[model samples]
Target chain A: MLSQLVFGAELAYGTMLYYLVLFLVLVLLIKVFAWKPINKMLNERTQQIVSDIDSAKQKHQEADSLAKQRQDELNKSHDEASTIITNAKQAGQKQQEQIVSDAQSDAQTIKDNAHKSIEQERQDVLANTKNDVANLSIEIASKIIQKELKANDQKALIDSYIEGLGKQNESR
Target chain B: MNDKISTFFLGGLTFNIGNMVAATVAAAIVLVIVVWLSRNLQVRPTSKKQAVLESIIDFSNTTTRGSMSDSDAASFKLYGFVLFVLIFVSNQLGLMLQVDVNGVTYVKSPTADPMFTMTLALFTIALSHYAGVKKLGFGGYFKNTYLEPFVFWFPLALFEEFSNFLTLGLRLFGVIYAGEILLKLVGGLAFSNGIVTIIGLAPIELIWQAFSIFLGAIQAYVFVTLTSVYINGKISAE
Candidate 1:
């Protein structure tokens, strides 16, 4: 009974044709169902990866440029600050020099005015002293002349008396 | 176990129809599964079924590409993959579709039939030559194939052509038919004894069934490999 399963092992032309058709149908179904879709998915994945890398690179370059711009602005502000400080320092120095020169000129003017006033005061004192001394000497000389005049008049009167007595005696 | 595919007389050609019907149904089932599994494929495959299909495609491409250029590999890999999956599945049909009709057991492995495999091999070899002719044109392909190194090689080349289909078909038929026979023998072993037969036959049947699946898959791989080799032979040697 089991040996009947062998069925003589005969090859057939009709079976060959049948299997070929079945095989081709299976091939067609598989091509439609599996091959096209899987390849599409793979291609989409590849494209997504490539575009991601490109965008990332572009963003990195932008960041680098922005950082460079920030650095430039910082440097420009620093230079501007330095220039402002330098200008302020020069203006302070000029103010100090002007103050010093003004003080010196003021002191010189005060000193010259004081010297002129002192010279005028000394001349007034000298004139007052001369007048006082001249007055004092004139007073003393007048006293002396007064006393001498009295004495001389007395002496002259006596001499005149003597002379007149002599002249009268001569005339008589 | 019967190797003869049931047939009917239609018009003039003896239409081989029963196993053809069975095989068509099996192929349709395969088609449905393939379509369903791959319908919503993702770049990053998520489901187990999707992953399994992807792995098969990947392995097929890798192995098939090993022997040929990328372009040829891409084009021919469809046939390779389709043959592998379909034959492998049909070979295992012996496991699933065993049935009794009027006290006779029938298993539905199309590849188990020598004629079926022989026919597939013939088609594959014929297509390979066709591809060769298409690639090199008729005269160039003829000179390249038949008159390669010398005219004296013609007989040997003809022998190679006949032998290619023989080997391709016989190898698969032998393995699958043997597996079916072994399964039958192990089933018979269970009938002869009590403890020893029970334990021994049960384990042997189970292990053989699993191994048979592995064997069937390997045979399918071999079939695809030989087909590609034949195609490469015509494409490259020219």
Candidate 2:
């Protein structure tokens, strides 16, 4: 058999032709059944992965921005709240000072009015005492003079002088 | 060994029906398996079968791209894939079982014959030349392939082309043919003395069969690798 292969074996042209045809058919079949669809699928999967990664990155950026915005709002509100508290505290302090000042002025006015009324009362009391003294002297002098005129007539005279004195004091 | 090939004459050409049948069977097996594995394929593969299929395709792609640019590899990858599958299957077919009726072998490895391997080698070389011409014009192709480095190297380059074709085809034929012959010789040991020979030589036969399987796979790889290299040689610039 080896000798025949080396020396006596004739070339098989028909087998070659058959192989050519078979190989071509096989290529065509594989192209339709395997290569086309598989290659397409592979390319599609790659594209899908790329797009998914891109979308994920975009979403991550969006989340970061949103978080930053929320933090900014939170910070602003915190500042606003502190300002309001400070403003309220300042207004309360001002009101407290105004109340204290008003009370001080009211006390001063009360003290001045009390002093004026006391002075007026003291002056009235002095004038009344002077009138009482004056009346008492006049009565004493008239009584002494009547007593020396006559013992019997002196009583009548003394009574008349005292009456006059009383009248005079009433008219003045 | 008696050389008996079943021949039929069609027109002026003689065909080896046995080899044609065997080759066709091998091709059919490859086609069915490939088509089936390719069916219901998802973008995200889930099945072990799909993984196997993808690995096969990846193996072919990687092998081709090793010798050529990705752009060039794209066109020839299917060719490389088909060549590898067909050759691999054909090499293993005879090892599984060889059918002999009378003195003619009805079933064997199609690649063991000189005619089929030579045909494959011829196609590969011719396709390379065609691609070379397509990539570079005819004048450029000629100068690059034969007259490169020095004009004095033309004869040697020409001789190299012939030798490349001869070696590529004959190498496959020689290895497979010799392997099959050794297998037969080992198998003959079992039948020589009935039971004792069968028992003792069974291990030897088994070992040789395993080795032959390994050889077939290697030869398939070598063939595809060389095919890509040849194509790359022609298409790429110095």
TM-score of chain B of 2: 0.97
lDDT of 2 by residue, A14-127 (tens): 878988888889888988998887888789889999999999999999999999999999999999999999999999999999899888888878887788787777777678
How big is the RMSD of model 1? 11.1
lDDT at residue B185 of model 2 (Cα atoms) = 90
Q: Which stretches of candidate 1 lie over 4 Å from their true place?
A: A1-8, A94-172, B2-5, B15-18, B103-107, B192-196
Q: What is the DockQ of each candidate?
A: 0.44, 0.61
| Candidate 2 runs further than 4 Å off | A1-8, A105-172, B101-103
- Chain A TM-score for each of the predictions: 0.59, 0.66
Error of 1 at B39 (Å): 1.9
Q: Using TM-score, give the best candidate's number.
A: 2
Which clashing pairs does model 1 show? Answer: A5-B1
Candidate 1, residue B114: Cα displacement in angstroms equals 1.8
DockQ of 2: 0.61
What TM-score would candidate 2 get against the native?
Answer: 0.85
